[model samples]
Target: MIDKLAWIRIENGAILTARSHNRDTYYIPGGKREPGESDHEALLREIKEELSVDLILETVHLVGQFEAQAHGKPAGTLVRMRCYAADYHGQLAPAAEIEEMVWLTYADRAKVSAVAQLIFDSIHQAGLLK
Candidate 1:
């Protein structure tokens, strides 16, 4: 299993997301933690590297944990996604190796990752997409 963390930055009713370099599906920003790193530390570093913005750790609110088949990978390799919502600073810019940064709404679930699609659906059903 691959452990992951992610965050949805809400702005003007839109959610910040990233598209992979070779794929169209969008995903929330965050990545795996290095050895010895805490969840907050990993999330903070990954977000900054991927989005070019420093995240305020205190703004983080635990959302929900999710598990799904890892996209484009082995069937049994699952991704356990720990999610959060948080505030951030600086302009919303895609950085480092990020291919594209996009804003998505509930209606855009079809263009998201396998796990994210489920999360999006849940958010919509619970009236949290807006």
Candidate 2:
């Protein structure tokens, strides 16, 4: 299993998604935790690196956890994603390995990873995504 962290930023019923350089599918922002790092530490570090934004520490909140077969991996490989929602400071821009950033709604589900599809399903069910 690949354990990962993801940030959920919703605006106008769409969720923020990122496509890394040379990658075809979009994914929720954030990444794996570094050694000995807490969730907040890793999430803050990742969002800063990937989205060029500072996630307000006090505003971070768990959204949900999700799991699915890993995309572009051998069958049976799974990704376990822990999701969070937070307010941030700074304009959202693609950075680090991220090649592009886009706001995606439920109608754009096919453009993301399996775990991200699950995220779409969840938020859509909650009536947060159009």
How much does candidate 2 score in TM-score? 0.99
Q: How many residue pairs clash in each candidate?
A: 0, 0
TM-score between model 1 and native: 0.93
lDDT of 1 by residue, 1-130 (tens): 8899998776666678897677767898999999999999999999999988888878988888888898888878888899988888877688877899988898787788888887787777777676
Residues 21-68 of candidate 2: C-alpha lDDT, one tens digit per residue: 999999999999999999999999999999999999999999999999
Output the worst ten-in-a-row residue range by lDDT, candidate 1: 121-130
Candidate 1 wrongly placed segments (more than 4 Å):
none
lDDT against the true structure, per candidate, is 0.85, 0.97
Error of 2 at 97 (Å): 0.6
Segments of candidate 2 deviating more than 4 angstroms: none
**What lDDT would candidate 2 get against the real structure?**
0.97
Alpha-carbon RMSD, candidate 1: 1.3
lDDT of 1 at 43: 94
